[model samples]
Target: MLKLLYNKKASAALANLSVGGRLPHAILFEGPQGCGKKLAADIAAQYALCEGEQKPCGVCSQCVKVERHTHPDLRYFTVPAGKKEFPIDLVRQLRQEAYIAPNEGCCKVYVIDQAHAMNASAQNALLKIIEEPPAHARFILLCENRSMMLPTILSRVTAIELELPTVEQCAQALASLRPQNSPEERQAAASGAGGNIGRALSLLETGKPARAMADAKKLCELLIFADRYQPLEILAGYDKDREGLLAMLPLLKGMFAQIAVSHYAKTGRDERVCNRVTPAQALDAAQAVEAAVRQAGQNVNIPLLCALMVERAKQALH
Candidate 1:
């Protein structure tokens, strides 16, 4: 399963554990969304259940069952949608199930995805299970942001940080998935995905890459031209989708960085496209844009954020 994609750090960690017998009973895999944390956890679970001397032998009955999500000892949990928190009752049920002997394997594996979504009470309830998990039980917690989870939960588990893949790697992986797409299409998808394979695939699945790319391109033009009219127009595009606006700010900042780098490389020094701006102007613009992106995560008003970004970009162009 590790070979199915490139996760060098996780692959190496698992290999080292298999050889040294230092594997932890509980683990927390943290990373940006759509980077394949769940896939890695599934691979680890299969390794734990493999019967032969070689773990995760794809042909082994245990591995096959796990692959099919039919392994009796493998349980999965996730926070339900529309609810702001995981209920304590769910954690209590898992704790009860943890003590029962594995019906078909040497270990019982529980994977809890979106663990950060758990509220304080639910987290505390799960903390007890982590503190004294059954001898044959193993738990894997997956979260997009470790900081959102309780420190007590973090302190008890071996944490693995997954990073977004490089653009080249993401392009290659995405190309394989879209066998019919042209090279240019694949490259565009990869760039727009920003190293997230799941997001790349999602864009492909929704047939939204073309639209997303168009939006990104327009955004770039607005930043470059310092058009006073563009921000209001952009705000209209984002007004109906508050959540999308929050996600898009980082992508815009990244695009601005790319533009700045290109400008620097070509000129050997920063020069404002518009009259009277300085290198410091460009730097300040980038920093302000990025800060606004971070601030959006804190629930700042979207229109206000967009207005600030436009004003900063215009200042940089002066």
Candidate 2:
């Protein structure tokens, strides 16, 4: 099952909560993109709406409906296509609908995808309902980074973080899911995506590395060379593409992490990033990239954010 394999910690926690009947009114599944936040949310929804005693028996009618996304009591929401932020109008509509009782089950589950993309206004609008949610209502928020969320919203939600699997694990999964592909192909895709299963599968399907990963790799090269002009030039390409910028952040973070690890481990390090910076500089740059990633979800101006990220990264290196 998607819940059991990739993230044991998250799986155990969600299972315990559902079995103990101690699920909170709101839950936030925070993780990098393609790290199974949506899958975890689906599992949580099943646990809440499942009619079986074991909670999400997977064979029960409610569980099947939830799996098929046919459960009336389970509602899914995301930023509308082509829209940059979660609009306030949608939040207002959802708030009005939240007052209604569940249609088929004892409780209602609302799965909000990209919760981090919610602007300050949308978050405030959502807080009103979450703060005093109806007895039968439940919320499961999916976010890439929790720092973009309002403190009040974060305070009310139970947060669950999911970790990426190893390249070997991801490759094994791909073998089962994409058996037509050779083992060599699977491993290559897995390594390219840094163990993100969703991204690896996408790589397999397209036979092309994602643009975000390419851009991130380029940025890593520029940072390693301590080039000033090229970093700004690359970042300017993302000024109008926040989603692309968001996708790139985790890749950048992962590369920096490798750089930091390489400094201490002295072997099995990425060739492109090895010996580029001092150990302290690599660690500091990793933190800098991480902070930039967290800040990306804050609805900040993309150009300004790119500038700040470049500045901090350079400062950490030099």
For TM-score, the strongest prediction is 1
178-235: candidate 1 lDDT, tens digit per residue: 8786554555566556668888677666544555455655775676664768756865
Q: Per-residue alpha-carbon lDDT of model 2 for 1-318, expressed as tens digits?
A: 335577989998887776576478899999998888888988998888877877778878888888888999999889999999988898898898899999988799999999898999999999999999999999999999999999999999999999888867988888888899766566656765767888888877864335666787789889879577898898898788665565577677777877877766756876655656776787787787777766766778888888888888899988
Q: Give the TM-score of candidate 2.
A: 0.64
Q: Rate the local accuracy (lDDT) of all candidates.
A: 0.73, 0.82
Which candidate number maximizes lDDT?
A: 2
> Which residues of candidate 2, in runs, are more than 4 Å off?
209-318
User: TM-score of each candidate?
Assistant: 0.65, 0.64
